[model samples]
Target: MKKQHFLVKQMPPEEIELEKKRAELSILEDDLALKELDLTTLQVVLEDLRRRYLRIVGVKLAQLDGIEAQIAEIIARLDPKNEEVKKEADRRRTQAQESADATGSIAAEEYEAEPFKPSEDLKQLYRDLAKKVHPDLAPDEQARERRHRFMQEVNQAYSERNEDRLRSLLNEWENRPDSVSGEGTGAELIRIIRQIARVHNRIEAISQEVENLKESELYKLKMRVDETQDESRNLLVEMAAEIDGQIEAAIARLKNISQRVEKTERSRTKQRDSKR
Candidate 1:
C-alpha cells in the first residue's frame, strides 16, 4: 500500500498569525452565512406553519359559528312564551358571544405580534460601545480590557432591553477618558456604524422576505393544497421539526464560538498587559 503524499509548508510567525486571524474571521463569516440561510429557511417554514394554524383555527371558528346558528334555530323553535326555553336560549347566546370575543382577542394578539425594536437611545449606546470595544482597537492591554468590558455591557443592555442603560452608556462613552478623537475616531466610528447597518439591513431584508411569503398566492394555495395532500402536510410538519432542530443547533454553535472568542480576547489582553 502506497502512503498518500502529504504536503507541508512552513510559514513565518507573522504569516502564521495572519493565517490564524483569517481562519477565525472565516469561521465567523461562515457562521453568519449559515445563520442567514437558516433564518431564511426557517422564515418560510414559519410562514407555512402560520398558514396551517390559521386554517385550522378558521375551520374551528366556522364550526363554532355554525353550531351557534343551530342553537339559535333550536331556540326559535321553542315558543317565546316558554320561560325555560327562553332562559336556556339566553344562556347559549351569552356563551356564544363570550367564545366569539375570546377568539377575536386571540386573532388580534397574533396579528399584533411584532419583533423587538431597540429604542433610539439603546441603539445610540450600542454604536458608541461598538466604537470603543471593537476588536481592531485592542492594540494594548488596557484598551483590550476596556473593549471587553464595553462589549459585555453592550450585550447585557441589549438582552435586558434596557433603553435607559444603553442611552447612559452612550453618554458615558462620549464623556469618558480615552475617548477617540479626530479623523481617526471618525474612521473607527464608520466601521462600527457599518457593522450595525449591515445587521439592520439583514434583519429588514429577512422581514420583507417574510412579508412576501405571507402575501404570496402560493402560500395561500398551499393551505388549500395541504387539505388534499396528506403526504405534503406530513412533510411540512417534518420540515418544521427539522427547522426547529437546525435553529437550536445554530444557537448552540454560536454560543460556543462567542465564548471561545471572548476567552481568546481576554487571554490576549492579559498577555499584552503583562509585557507592558
Candidate 2:
C-alpha cells in the first residue's frame, strides 16, 4: 500500500460557539450562586428577626396587661366613667383581631391549612432540577460535591417557591463544561437549546424576585433597623432595652396605683363621691 496523507478539519463556528458559551456560563453561574447565598441568608435573618420581634412584643404586652388592668380597675373605682375606657379597649382589640384575620399572619397567626403547599408547576420544576444536578450523576468526587451543594440550593429554592432560582440552576448546570462540549452528541445539543430557553425564564424570575424583595415590608423595616447601629449596639439590643424600661415604668405605675388604693381603702367618702 502506498503512504497516504490525511487531514483533520477545524471545528465549525457553531461548535466553537457552543464551547465558548459553556465557559462563559460557568463563570456567570458562580457569580449568581454567591448572590443567591447572600439573598438567602438575608431572607433567613429577616424572618428570624420578625419572629423574635413579635415574640418579644408579646411578652412585653402581657407584662403590661396586668398593670393596665389594675390601673383601669383603680381608675374606675375613683371615677365611675373610667369603666368606658375598658369597653373602648375591648372594642379596639376586637377590631385589631378582625383586621389581622382578614390578612395573612406571620406571627401569632393561626392557619387552618398547610402554610406551604408546593404548586404542581413548582413540583415539576423541582423534579427537573433535582434530576439535572443529582450528585450521583457527577463524574468525580469534586463534581459530586459541587452537585451536592447545587442540589441543596435547589431544594431550598423549591421549598421557598424560588422558581427563578430553580430554573436558573437547571440552566446553569446544563452548561457545565463536562456536561456540554463541542463534541457533544445531537441529543445533547437539543438539551442545551432547551436549557437556553430556561435561562431566559430564569432572568425573568430573578427580576420579579428583586422587585418583590425590595417592596417587602420586612426588607424596609430591616433597612431602618440597620441604620440605628453603633459599634456596641444593634437594633434588636436597643429594642430589648427599651422594652425593659417600659416594663419597669409599668411596674412603677402599678405600685403607685396600689398605694393609692390602700390609702383610700377606708374612705367611704371617696366611694360616695365616685358614685355621684
* Top of the candidates by TM-score: 2
Model 2 ranges with Cα > 4 A deviation: 1-8, 12-14, 51-58, 65-87, 91-184, 224-229, 251-276
lDDT of 1 by residue, 68-163 (tens): 544543544435577787777676677666656655544655442322345565545555555444433444456657866876776666645677
Error in Å for residue 182 of model 1: 11
Colliding pairs, model 1: none
The positional error of residue 72 in candidate 1, measured at the CA in angstroms, is 8.1
Clashes by residue pair, model 2? none
> Candidate 1 — which residues are off by over 4 angstroms?
1-18, 69-276
State the number of backbone clashes in model 2.
0
Q: For residues 1-276, write the lDDT of model 2, one tens digit per residue.
A: 999988989987767767766665555444444444434445555665565555545445545554565566666666656768767555545554553443325445542222244567766676666545655444456766887798888868865778788788888878877543344445444445555554445546656776787798877867766677444446655676787788789789878988887788758778888999
The 0-to-1 C-alpha lDDT of every candidate, in the order given, reads 0.55, 0.61
Question: On a 0 to 1 TM-score scale, where does candidate 2 land against the true structure?
Answer: 0.50
The clash count of every prediction, one per candidate, is: 0, 0
lDDT of 1 at 143: 64
